[model samples]
Target: MRIAFPSTEKLGLDSPVYAHFGSAPYFVIVDADGGDVETVENKDLHHLHGNCQPLRALGGISVDAVVVGGIGRGALTKLNQEGIVAYRAVEGSVSENLALIKNDGLPRFNIDQTCQGHGRNGECIH
Candidate 1:
């Protein structure tokens, strides 16, 4: 199976997951058994929500699972509707996060929780 982890930098295993423009995509594709890794730039479709196309963008890839810091309910619903497992409360670099996910499995992301609307550091609240 192919696993995808969102990250900040392309190098390292724990680079942290942050959005560049409402689209914080730092996906790392890895083999389930050997852990072989390949990196892919996730399409930033946050700006193209005019017709709800982000889901299509994500679906373009062969990702089975996604690890992200935080996401809104709308996005979460879309992911779930598409049969993609969404992991929340995640933070770290692409490589390190992948290792953590590979070894620890999916962590509790608190999907029901909402942020109080903070700026910058709290921009991902939802």
Candidate 2:
């Protein structure tokens, strides 16, 4: 499966996962089956409040799922509509998050769990 992780930098697997998907600087796409990884800059990083377009940020790159520390309700809904699942990220690097995913330790992101305009610390409020 192709998984995308919102990142603060382009450090490949070791990239630190950004707290909020919409404002993240980059995305690290990882191929779970082949262990390949690539980074893409987030095109819609500067979107206005509540105007995050998750797909646009991906720049048309197809990914099976996205792992993020937090995401807004609109972005989560958009991702669901596009058939891409979102998972709540664990506190770790892209590589560590990948490991958690492989072990089924990460929770699937749901609309009810969307962020409530929290700051960078990623404290999502229901």
Candidate 3:
């Protein structure tokens, strides 16, 4: 499976996962079965609206799924439409979160719960 995780850095799987998909400087693409990983910059994505563009950007990569800390309802819906399952991963570095997703497929992506308490921190809201 080709899994893409929004990240701030390109230092392998240990890169930090970004809170918002759009603002993520680059996306870390991992070929789970092949164990190959690479980073792709999001210059083509317009993330300010927090809408479907990031999902579209991901679609271009042919990613099978997206694992992230949180995503808005609109983005989530679009991702689902594109056949990409959304997994809610919270409070972990990039590698750890991706490993969790690989070990357990489609874990409960509770956007509401994981995105809570984050509003105060000025991060993206679900």
- Give the winner by lDDT: 2
- Report, for every candidate in turn, its global Cα lDDT versus the true structure: 0.55, 0.91, 0.71
Clashing pairs in 1: 13-95, 13-96, 14-93, 14-96, 15-92, 15-93, 16-92, 16-93, 19-24
Tens digit per residue, CA lDDT, model 1, 1-126: 566565555763445665321354455555666767765565664454323333454446766666666655555666667677766534446665565666775574444842323367546544
Task: Give the per-residue Cα lDDT of candidate 2 at 119.
Answer: 48
**What lDDT tens digits, residue by residue, belong to model 2 across residues 9-112?**
99999998877889898999999999989999999988997899998999999999999999999999999999999999988899999999999999999888
**CA RMSD per model (angstroms):** 3.7, 1.6, 3.0
Per-candidate TM-score against the hidden true structure: 0.67, 0.94, 0.80
Best by TM-score: 2
Candidate 2 runs further than 4 Å off = 120-126
Give model 3's clash tally.
0
Off by over 4 Å in 3: 110-122
Error of 1 at 124 (Å): 1.2
Q: Residues 8-112, candidate 3: write the lDDT tens digits.
A: 788778888778665567888888889889888876366455444755565478888778777666666677777887787666676788778778944755445
Worst 10 residues of 3 by lDDT: 109-118
Error of 3 at 100 (Å): 1.0
